[model samples]
Target: MNLTYLPLFYDLSSREQRDALNELMARNPAIQLIDNILEQIQELVRVLFPSETIGEENLKQRVEVYLQNVDLATYGTWVYYPWLEKIVHLLNEEDFIRVRTSRNMYKIDQKEIATLGKKKIGVLGLSVGQSVALTLAMERTCGEIRLADFDHVELSNMNRLRCSITDLGINKAILAARQIAELDPYIKVRCYTDGATEDNLDDLLLVGGKLDLLVEECDGINMKILSRLKAKEFQIPVLMDTNDSGMLDMERFDLEPDRPILHGRLKVLEGLSSIAIAEQLRNLSFPEKIKYLSEMIGIENVSDAMKRSLPEMNKTIVGWPQLASSVMLGGAMITDVARRVLLGQLQSSGRFFVEFADLINDDPDKDFCRS
Candidate 1:
């Protein structure tokens, strides 16, 4: 253990550092195996000192010296991944976060990155929401995340979701959390397999400090409005990406606690009970649902494709079309907006359209060459 070489672990006593190293090595055989030590050292040296080339002889000398003085116990310990019904040994949190997110520096910056790590964000749906949740984790945008998705992964979900066939039937929330754990075990992920509802809304929003922001991507129409209602009550900002025509809806309830829900869409929905709203949306014809959706995002801003899909819903198609492109775009879009919103950089909220059609068509700097 050369304290000078690994300054980050200098705070720990020799015994503690040895224990951490041993624990880490135990789980990672490549690090523990004598035959692989040189290779490991070479890789580490490359990553640590990319600009300075240390030859194999020098690398071995460095690694041997470091290993000789470093005697730690328990390289890793098993963590029960309840969702997958398995226990697995994982790397310690600090080491994991450090190495995994080391490349995200300067671009994310220290100030906003620090702010993001302290914020606890909640994701209510895991279909397209899974993309948002995982993107958030991948970016190290939040230290703790609450995922609430009742649906299990089905065959159809694989079309748009970044999941394998082996994961079919697992709860979406748990799946998302497991993926997050794999990416950054340091991130605190809490899953609600039952999904966010009236019974658990309070716990989801207020538990472990009221959520800094809530990303509502649930399919339940009533839950969408209801979650916003609760978010407004608690003064938490909400971000939702429709995954249709690149629509991103933002509600800055934290800024204006009394801000109208869905931007005051469908005023007829004002007095309707949640149960009534749910029932209405559930049974509405495709045209009716489109009408409601139009109100939510504003009819003028709605995409032509989105408007056209309503007629086919429950007819030629069992549900509206969802593309992997749109879903992934939604994830990136919402995560960026969520990051800005969480950092208080984005002060106002409204609907934003990032549709490819409009963007390329209206490009002011583009010149078309007619063939």
Candidate 2:
């Protein structure tokens, strides 16, 4: 129904406001009270809307009855704008999310947010990955998102993860799905509550699956080895955000798949067995690797942080940042890459390293060595 918020909020402040509205409706011959009815109905919808619940179409007929008798405001916004803003801030709620615009301020056209009417995104890991999913939901970037992770949100992860303390024991993927739905009912979310493996991975991302940009945020060597190789074989772009020494390393697989260049080192990702990947990581130069990891995480609690139940050789990568540094450079770099990719303006180069402390934003455009 066509309505504006002015009359309803005013109905709250002074008895004079509500009484005036009723008296005016009773006496006025030109302006119908239909607008008031529509406002009340919308308010009811906002109040009664349930979480993980669907609304019936039954109310539309009744709403249409009032709408047809009324005239919508010529301007998208009106005197009620400030009042509604006040209520939202005062009430500190967002269940009834709506955006407003003013007729006079039409000159400024912001870049349109992606209309995620029914699009999808697939996410791996729910550490930083959970935060990424929540941000995407908040922006309404995808109609559906498939969250894949075998881990559970644990007590130690509460500070940086999006889950609540209540969600501490839930499987990450399932918990992430619930979180997304709770954040925005309109979004369709699913989960691969089990580990994303070589066999069931593709099934989890087919038609009834998530087939959008795949986000690789898992922190395990096996998870990453499978993810990258699978994406390469499938000819899909796989993006990885690695937290290293107060920086983020962003890489996209299959950069030039048709004319694939060679980098022998990246063979670390080519169909390696879980044990092989672990051994390869362990064989890295320990002193240098540990130093780099220490710088990234900024702490001396490598053992304490390992409560995350990582690989037997997980210490290889853990030194990369899990506890050596206490910064969030990794998240910032991930955000930058996401922006460029979404804009269809991703750099030609497939990998980038961003150092937050140094503030270096390297162009991911130059030719990389073939090795």
Candidate 3:
């Protein structure tokens, strides 16, 4: 993680350096406007685009002409990522609002987009949570987002997560943060590298002020319940999406503070504290945890292959199966629900499954396909 960009002009021939400078200027009209506004266009060009044959007077005239149509106030300072070194012109808030969300159109009105952009969101677990986090950023739904995941990117995660091979072994939380940074620099990103636990749960949930919403998708059953407890305590809404069968759970503690966590689905978790739950599973072997996870997520909710493979974990396979389609769909659906919840248009508290079975089972052409 080197975060520095140093252009080595000394390595290039004078002609090549000049050509590079010309290319840079051609690509960034924002810098030209900045130079013109400061009345240092000539000096700036001379400093950065030095040439033996081109006189100072000639350079000044050329730069001044190039900046005639450039709008100085429409953009601010140029920024480049330390690692990638790609320069980007910062846009004014109004211009940014228009350009970043131009495709949202009539679906999300400008007022709603503006409102959503100011809200803060938190996402736990980066495997499937990565999609949800990125989707939220894509919609410009939340201006500030916090991500928590202690796991590193493994080759196995590529099945559902959208990342290249180069991302292997990187911290999932940081990977998500970096991707979000590259997508929208205006979005403030925070990551808890250690994942959510008693040590950092407060910071993640309440210390920096309660998050507008929490999206919990971690493998830790305790976190799944504990996070909801905290959300309920703070009267903050929480949303989660289990990729299988498009099962989505919305717990609007703000609307119904007394609502049972997970709609009281797992009776075993009714009165258990997170510490007690952790102690109960502390002695379980790795394979046992996998099998326990299958049960925790509801064995019936998973694909047949995943359910079948659970028993094979210690003897054959390493983990469960996940599909790119389900992960991506979880991302899109969670973001949609997050927006609705944030905008106060939805206040329901229950489970909703966006499964294809309903559609496929009801299809009038089903008999034709079967025949």
Candidate 2 stretches greater than 4 Å from native: 1-118, 249-255, 258-264, 268-336, 360-371
lDDT (10s digit) by residue, model 1, range 1-371: 11110012212335676566556556754432222323434454455665777887777776676557553324333344333433344434544454466677767776777778899999999999999999999998898999998888889888898899988878888788878876666688888888998789989999889999999998766678778888988999999998876889888999888788988876987887766765665556656656666677676776687768667778787766788999999999988988888877888888888887656665556546212
lDDT of 2 by residue, 209-304 (tens): 446466777755445655655555555555555554333333344355542312233433356664575466554564545443444333442344
- In candidate 3, where is summed lDDT lowest over 10 consecutive residues? 3-12
lDDT of 3 at 146: 92
lDDT tens digits, residue span 217-266, model 3:
88876677677777888888999988887889898999999887777666
**Candidate 2 clash total?**
9
> Best by TM-score, which number?
1
Q: Give TM per candidate.
A: 0.79, 0.54, 0.76
The root-mean-square deviation over C-alpha atoms between each candidate and the true structure, in angstroms, is: 7.4, 15.2, 10.2
Worst 10 residues of 2 by lDDT: 83-92
Ranking by lDDT: 1, 3, 2
lDDT of 1: 0.75
Backbone-clash count (model 3): 0
Error of model 3, residue 221, in angstroms: 2.0
Give the Å error, residue 270, model 1. Answer: 3.9
